[model samples]
Target: MTRLDTLSARGRDFLGSTHAIMAGAMTWVSERNLVSAISNAGGFGVIACGAMPPHILDAEIAATKALTDRPFGVNLITLHPAMADLIAICGKHDVSHVVLAGGLPSGAAIEAIKATGAKLMCFAPTAALAKKLVRSGVDAIVIEGSEAGGHIGPVSTSVLAQEILPVIRDVPVFVAGGIGRGAAIAAYLEMGASGVQLGTRFAAATESVAHANFKRAFVRASARDALASVQLDPRLPVIPVRALKNAGSEAFAAKQREIANLVDAGTIGLAEGQLQIEHYWAGALRRAVVDGDIESGSLMAGQSVGMVTSVMQVAEIIDELVGEAEAALSNRAA
Candidate 1:
């Protein structure tokens, strides 16, 4: 096998794909077209089931399956109210992998996915959690850092890798965030990463159904344009979301303040307030991704946004990534 394949062997085998590269399950953008395209291109595609009801997710999985016979996965938000039903849909469709995101999954959720005979993957913010998830019977672990788009934790990808990779050995560990090139992939693989996940770069892919304005915005953006939101209230327990600076981002701060006030006034409890905040983000993202409302919609993107210079085909993007990784490994050997 070639250098790229060699480095990605474990992850590739686990994913049943030619490359271990996974397209990050971006909400609104990671629907049937892009997901199938990635899987057809010999990379893994994960359908983002962000707040999607069970029926919608079922149809999505079916649509994606019709488009490609290649293996792909489904990403389900752990906190989604229909988590159990979603897992059942994945089982009904026999999805090969089920990734749990948004928050730590309960044992019941883990068992439900595994009961479907699907490989289970969960995100870990710390090494402690990595070990804990492994002990909980997760088939794999994804360590996404603060530079990642959408919701994020405080640590950087490199720091998380340094802290988690050496210590977690039982299952495949995929590193994400701020990784826009093959050289970065090579570095992580050398550090024992099974593979990598990228979202922003793929968001502009020709196969992605993101609106033209959305693609254009990503094309023109720089790394600095992507900033993580701040928590306006300690009681609200907001998760920092990294996205391109826009009116919608500023609006989110105001929205948070408003929700926090509701929490203060007893109009809504913390849980209900947080749910409203989540719904607001979902709507805002759909506005940007589907409706082309760039100014007041969430342009969720990673620090890798600058590298997405143009809209490219999914196959082309995967080839370029593998090529870059090969060159990096070759240069190191030389």
Candidate 2:
């Protein structure tokens, strides 16, 4: 049998795809074109419904459906003010899979998604949470680490996989973070992961609508160049966002320091100060992705950005990944 045949059946069954690979949802990037392309290429594609209102999400889902009949998923930020409404929108579209990201989901949100008969997938930051999510009736869990782009956890992908994969058997766990090639996917599958998710590697796909400058930054970057945002003050509730280092990252640091100084001087309330810090990154990703302003906008990417050398069609990228994974698995068997 071929190595691709060795992939976990649970994953293939759950995703209803030819392979257990998923193109991680990237804000402003995973739109109709790219999502449909990935699905048509035999992998699962997820739409990143980041902070979009119900109407916009509805259109995006419909647009993607028009492009491909293959299965795809929608990723929703759990803390979005319109979480409930978004869940309803997914149901309206009969979305087959829903991935709740950003944070732990509220019971009402979870129940709402379950009511739609769509499989629920949530990010598991730890082994305990993985078990807890399974008990809460989530159909699957995605264990993503700090090496991933955008907001991230504190642990590394390798460590999180070791800690969670062995303990969770009730639901298939898809590992994400720092995965750039199929060899890494094969390793995780061998370690019992049902599948793998990749974001940075796909962000530069030809199908992605990200501006040429944004994709260029990713192509020129090395793993070391992808750094996580730092919180200058613990009192501030700024979540760390991983991105490529640039003038924008440095400017964010300066903005945080200014906010902290204001709070220390009693010039601004603590809550207001935190909000100011948080708002600094607002629209920054779109600035980079849409406007091609890599200097002053967030170049959100993972350490795997180094591995992305050029923009190819989504199908070509998937073919390369599957081929590499097969070679690795075959070599191991030989």
Please tell me which predicted candidate would have the highest lDDT against the true structure.
1
- Full-model lDDT for every candidate: 0.94, 0.91
**What is the TM-score of each predicted model, taking all chains together?**
0.98, 0.97
Over 1-334, each residue of candidate 2 has an lDDT whose tens digit, in order, gives 5766667567989999888999898989999999999999999999999879999999999999999999999999987998888999999999999999988898888899999999999999999988889989899999998999988889999999999999998889999999999899899999989999999978999989999999999999999999999888888877889999999999998998898899899999999997776567767898999999999999999999989999888888889988999989989989
Spell out the clash pairs found in candidate 2. none
Cα lDDT for residue 170, model 1? 88
State the weakest 10-residue window (summed lDDT) of model 1. Answer: 1-10
Would you list the clashing residue pairs of candidate 1? none
Q: Which stretches in model 1 have alpha-carbon errors above 4 Å?
A: none
